[model samples]
Target: MTLKTCSRADGHVRAFPLARTLPLLGALTLLPLTSQAADQATGEDAAGQTASYETTEQAPRSEYLSDWYNQNVTIIGSKNIRFGPQQVDDIYLEYEFFGRKGPWDLYGYIDLPKFFGTGNGADSGIFDNGSPLFAELEPRLSLNKASDMDLSLGPIKEWYLAVDYIFDWGHNSNNRQSTLYAGIGTDIDTHTPVGLSFNFYKRYQGDNYGAANEDQWDGYRAQAKYFLPLATFGNGAKLDYVGFTNYDFGSDLGDRDASRTNESVVATNVLLYSFTHLRFMAVARYFHNGGQWNDDAELNFGDGPFHVRSTGWGYYLGVGWQF
Candidate 1:
C-alpha cells in the first residue's frame, strides 16, 4: 500500500542490501520501467542472506541506471480502510522503484486504486471509470556521498536530506490531495541483521480536499521504517518482515471540525514472501485518528448525522511480480 490514500508503507523495492524502505510500499514509477530493468534475487546463502539478484529482461536506459536499482509490480487487496465516516474496501495496482546511485537514494510507487473494479461496493477501477491515480515519491540525498564526509557516528551510519511527496488526481477539490514532507533522515546500523531508518519531516500541504488548512504549512511527521530477515527456504523461497510508522502532529485540524483531529498515527506491519518471480505479502495496519478524522466525534454528513470511526485496523494482501 502506498497509502491509506495518505499514510505510510516504506519500501518494497529489491534495491537495497536488505531492501528499499518504502510503505511508501516503495511508489509511482510507471509499470513499464521496472520490468525490463528489474534485478531478481535467485540465490541465497545458508544464513538466509541474499546471495545475489540477476538482472533480467532488457536493461533500463543505461544513463538512468547506475549503481543498482529494483522495481516490482504488485496488486493489493485491502479491507476496512476508513475514508471519512466510512470504511471502504479496495484493490489497487502498485508500481514501485528504489535505488541508490552516487549521492541520491530514491523510492517511489504508483497506486492505481480500483484497478480491478470489484470490491465492497465502494470500489472502482481505473479501467472501469471508477478510479483515480495516487502515487508517492521519496528521495534522499546522502551527506556522506555528496560531501565526501564520514558522517557515520555511533549507531547512525549516515545522514540524509530527505523528502516525501504524494499526489492524487481526484475529481474535484474535495477529493484530491497533494502533500510534501521535507526534512532530515538517518540510517541506523543496528550491528545486527535488523535495519532501521528514521526521517523527520515538516509538512507543506496542498490541495487538501477543501479543508481549512489547504495549501498551507501544517504539521510534522516522524517516520520510522525497519527490515528484518527472518528465514530462507531450501527452495530459495524467503520470508521477511518489514514495516513503518508515521506519526503526524502539530496541525489545527480539530479547530475547524468536531470530526477531525490535530494529530494522527499510522503503523504498518508486513510479512512478505518471495520465490523467484513471484511474491506474496500480508499487511496489518493500525490507525489512530486516521486521515486526521477524530476517533470519536459527531458530524453531519449533509444527508444526516453520524459518528466518525477513525481508529482501528486495516488489512492488505498482495501478490506481485518482482521484475
Candidate 2:
C-alpha cells in the first residue's frame, strides 16, 4: 500500500496511510490532524479540523502585504512651461497603502509650486522669463517647485488619525503659507469603496512686505472619494469621483469676519498601456462665500477672509512612471 500525493496551488493532499486506511474503511477522511496543525501555525484557528486554502494565493502573501504597506512609496514631480490661467510649475509626492486589515487607511500628499502672476491677472510674461531656463533645467528645478506632505497613523484598526500639512512658496512675492491639519475618517467597503475624511487646521500666511498683518486662518474641510471601476477593463481601468467642501471659522485680520463654502467634483481615469504611463483627470469647482471683506476687497488672496464665487476651474493632464 503505497501513499500517493497531489499538489495544487495551495497545500498538498496525501492519500491516507495504508495502516490508517483500514480503520476508516476507505471513507476518505481528510487528514484532520495535519490540517489542524497547519491551521494553527497559520493563525487560522477557526478552520478547526477542516482543510481549506484561499482561492487565490498571492505569493508569500504575508511578505507581499508587509512590503506593499511599508516599502511601497511613490514620488512624482512635473512642470508646465506654457503660460496658462494659473501659470503653475508644481511638484507632488504621494504615498499609499492598500493591504492594511482595517476599515480605513492613512494617505496624504504634498503640493508645491510657484506662480508668477495672480490667477486672474494678465500674463506678465514673468512665468515666461524662466520658460527657457525652466525647460533647460526642467530636470532640476521641476523637482524643487513645491512640497505637500501628509501622513495618517491608524490607532483603532479601521479608524485612522490623519495629520497633513501643505507649504507653498514660489514666484508671486515668494509668499509662504503653512497649514497644520488633523482629522479622522473611515474606509467603508461597498460596491464602490467610500472614504470619508474631515480635517481642521490652522493656516499661517507669511507676508513679504514686512507688514504686521501676517495673518492666521483656522478652518475645517471635509471630503469624500468613491472608487469606480470599469467593467470592460476589469480592474485595469479605474475611476475615482471626489467631492469636497471647506469653511473658515477664524482669521487674524481684525474687523474681518469671513466664511466660505466650496463644492467640487472631479473625475480621474487610469489608462492601461505597456509602453507609456498615462492618466487623465477633469475637475469642476464651485465656491461661494461672503462676510468681512467686500467682493472686491484687496484681501491677501492667500490669506483668509476672501470670498470666491463659483467662477474658477482647474484641470490637469499627467503622465508618470514607476521604477
Candidate 3:
C-alpha cells in the first residue's frame, strides 16, 4: 500500500509590518508592582517589627552570579500555524557556578525547527513553505532547513558567549553543508522593573561540492532582548515581552568573491510562571528577513546553483525546569 502525504508547502514568504509591533505593545501592557500587590493582602500588626519579621523570608532577593552552574536540563517543542506547518524540537543541558558569589552558567542544545518526515523524498512534508511557488504547479517540498547544535557560557553578572554548529543534509539535492558560529552578549539591569541585552555573532560556512561562486560564506549578526514584569498569577507568574533582530554582513560567496548582506527580525511575548522545581512559559513569535542573501534562490546547494532564500514568520511555546 502507498502512503499518502500531507499537501502543505514547507516555507512560504509573507510580510506584515503591523505584526512586528505587537510584541512592543504587549511589553508596554505589563502591570505595575503596586497594582500587583493589591491583588492579595494579609493581616497587619500594629507593631512595625511584626510586619518586617513576618515578611522577611518571603521577600524577593537578588541572586549571586555564582548560582548559574548547578546541574539542570530543559526540553521544548513548538508548532507553527502556517500552511506548510513547521515544528521545532530542542534539548538542553545546564550547569551553574558554585556558592552564589557570582553567577555563571553553561548550556548546550540541539535545535530542529524544521523536519520533513520521510515520504515522497521530502524530509518534512509535501510542500516547501520556504519556496516561492506558482499557483499552477504541484508544489515541490524540500527537506527542513537543517539542524543546529550549540553551547553557551556566561558569567551571570553581565556577559555571555555562545558557539554553534549548523548541519545541512540536502535531502533532495544529495548535498551537505555546515557552518561554525560564535557570539557574545551583554546585559544591563540598573533600571528597575526593566532589563536589556545586546548580542553579536559571526559565522563561517564550509566549502560547497564544486561550485566556485558558492563554495563558502561568512556573515555577522546583532540582536537585543528586553524584559518587564507584570501582575503575578497567584504565587509566581508574570507576563513579559522580548524582541530581537539579526543583521548579517560580509561575503555571500567564497574567499575571493565580493560580499552580500542579510537581515532578519523576531519578536515574542511570553507569560512566565515559576515553581519550586519548574518554570512554565508560553510564547508567540513573528519573524521577517530581507536582502540579496535573504532570498532562497541565493542559497548555495553544494554542487550547483539552488534557487532558495530564507525569509518568513513563525511562533513557539516552551517550558523549563530548575534544579
Candidate 4:
C-alpha cells in the first residue's frame, strides 16, 4: 500500500497508510495528533485529543491520559505602554511556560520592562536608558492527579496547592526583592475555561536571599482568569480573548512608620489572533497599587512609593511565536 503524507507548518509530517480506508474526518483528526506532537510549542487544542477514531477496524482514543501535563510556552512583547496609580512609560517583554510533571503543575515567566519615564514628573526621563527584570516560578501539587483520584467538587475540574515565588532586580538597584506565595487553585472547564485561586504572600528585600527586609508585608491575594473565544478566521486562524484580575488585601506592613494599607487591584485584558503558531496580541491593563512599602527608605528608590499615582491604565501591542 502506498502511504500518503502531509506536512504541518512546523515541518512535521503525518503519514496515512491506505488513504482509501480512512475517511476525510478520520484523516483530519489524525492531522492534529501528529501536528501537536510535532510542534510541541504552540499550545494544542484542549479538546482535540479526546475523540475516538473508528473504521472497519477499531481505533483507539486519540489521546491517552498521562501522568504528565502538556508543555506550553508563550513569549510576548508590549510597546508604548502607559499604566497607572504609578503611571509608567515602558516597553515590556515576557516569556511564560506551563507544564505538568508527575503530580505537579509548573508555571512561571520572566519579564523585562524598559522604562522611558513616568511621562509627567521630575523623574519623567529617569529610565530612559535602563530596564528592570523580573522572574517568577510556580510549581503546584495536584492532590487529585497525584493520587490518581477524581477529586471533583461541584463544578471544579481539578484542585491543587501551589507556591509562587517572584524576584525582581536590575534597573541599577543592586538589591533585589523576593516575594513568596502559597495558595490553592481550582480549574473550571465549562463552556469557557476559568481559573480561581487565593494566595498569601510575604516579601523579603536585600542583596542576599535571606537578607532582612527594609520593608516587608504579608497579605492575601485572590486571582481569576477567563478565556473567551471570538471568531475563527479561514484556514485555522482564530481570535481569542483572556481577562485576568487580581486583588490584594494586605494585612500588615513590616515598616512600623508606613501608614498605607498596601491593598491593590490589577486587571488585564488580552485579545489575540493566531495563525499557525504565530500570534499577534493587544493588551490593556489597569493597576491600582495602593500598597507602597516606602521605596525610598527600603530600596532608596527616591520618592519611595509616593511617586506613583493611585491608579492608571496602560496599553500594548505585540507579536510572538508560541513554541
lDDT by residue (148-267, candidate 3, tens digit) is 222223423355554434333333322333445567655545447555655566765552222233334456655454555554433334343333333445544424432223434444
Query: What order do you get sorting by TM-score, best first?
Result: 1, 4, 3, 2
lDDT: worst 10-residue window of model 2: 132-141
Stretches of candidate 3 off by over 4 Å are 1-67, 70-75, 81-105, 111-177, 207-217, 240-242, 251-261, 290-310
Please give the RMSD of candidate 1 to the true structure: 6.4
| All candidates: TM-score | 0.81, 0.42, 0.46, 0.61
Quality of model 2 by C-alpha lDDT = 0.23
For candidate 4, which ten residues in a row score worst on lDDT?
Answer: 1-10
lDDT ranking, best first: 1, 4, 3, 2
What lDDT, from 0 to 1, does candidate 3 have? Answer: 0.30
Model 1 segments more than 4 A misplaced:
3-5, 8-67, 124-131
1-323: candidate 2 lDDT, tens digit per residue: 00001100000111111000111111111111011111111212232311112223454324223322221222222222111212222322222122222222323221111121222221222253321111000000111112222232352112344444433232343332233445544333343333333333333434312223344433343433333322222222323333333343444432333222121121111211111112222222222222112223234445445423322222222222211
lDDT per residue (tens digit) for residues 135-199 in model 4: 55666688888789999887777788866565555344433445565777776657433323333
Q: What would the TM-score be for candidate 1 when compared with the true structure?
A: 0.81
In candidate 2, stretches whose alpha carbon ends up further than 4 angstroms from where it belongs are 1-157, 170-174, 188-195, 198-217, 230-236, 250-254, 257-277, 289-311
- Report the Cα lDDT for residue 151, model 3: 26
In angstroms, the error of model 2 at 29 is: 56
